[model samples]
Target: MAHPATDDARLPRSGSALDVAEYFAPQRTSSEDLPEIEPLVKNLTIGVLEVLAGVREVDQLARWLGEDAYRALVTRSNLSARARSARGVAAVRPAHRILTQRLCEPTDGVVEAVVVVAGPARTRAVAMRFEGWDGRWRANSLALL
Candidate 1:
């Protein structure tokens, strides 16, 4: 039997489109291009919970929120009542843990996360949207349900 030619046209050659180089090349993604955001979300969510529980003052969240959100939160007169209701049977400082977190990007520089928080006596879902501005994550919107 005769051996096949090493330069056979059927064989893939280096730098060809069929080469695996392109497939293995490093991929660029939005997440990679942007800064890390999940840890910010976690901390912000915890702070929001603390505010809702009245264990933390709304002013403490000011730095994390945008101007509009901060103003709205600060002016809301019912936070104390809501906090009392959420506290339920737990003490002044309830143990809260994140149960689930889902994240998505609605647009560039914006990340939204829906998180479930479980406390000693109650559980609630919190949705927070963050925008990357001035090289930091700022709360664009926050809602509790």
Candidate 2:
């Protein structure tokens, strides 16, 4: 008798396993399928600045950020907090206004944006790249200049 463990019918076809795994993985949605990108980008810019300024907790924005972006924000926030502690500065809401926002879509589900913000101290730009993931936008990369 043939061994049941070695039965070909019990195993998935060569490439079907990969297909099955991918089917269960988080799906990538196109920008056309997602909500407006401008609003999300603007919100994230302000959120990131607030977190760095010690006025907001990084966890508050975790839902919209990818793993790497979230970790980077946490690290930057920690550094900011340490600096504030050394200077004996208390956390205060940063006064800033969004000046200009420019967005570009290089591919179907990706958006790159730069937002200029005018703060009481100086004007700065926040750059971010967003990807449509699982039917929503997620920030995978962020930088404040």
Question: Which candidate should be chosen as best, given lDDT against the real structure?
Answer: 2
TM-score of each: 0.65, 0.87
Tell me how far the alpha carbon of residue 70 in candidate 2 is from the true structure, in angstroms, after superposition: 1.0
Among all windows of 10 consecutive residues in model 2, the one with the lowest summed lDDT is: 11-20
Tens digits of per-residue lDDT for model 1, 1-145: 4346665765666677656766676333344456788888888888877766567788877877987777666655255656656767342664789999999988777889999999888888988888776566788788778
Clashing residue pairs in candidate 1 are none
Among these predicted structures, which one has the highest TM-score? 2
Residue 94, candidate 1: Cα error in Å is 1.9
- The CA root-mean-square deviation of candidate 1, after full C-alpha superposition on the true structure, stands at 15.4
List runs of model 1 lying over 4 Å from the truth: 1-34, 75-78, 81-91
- lDDT of each prediction vs. the true structure? 0.74, 0.93
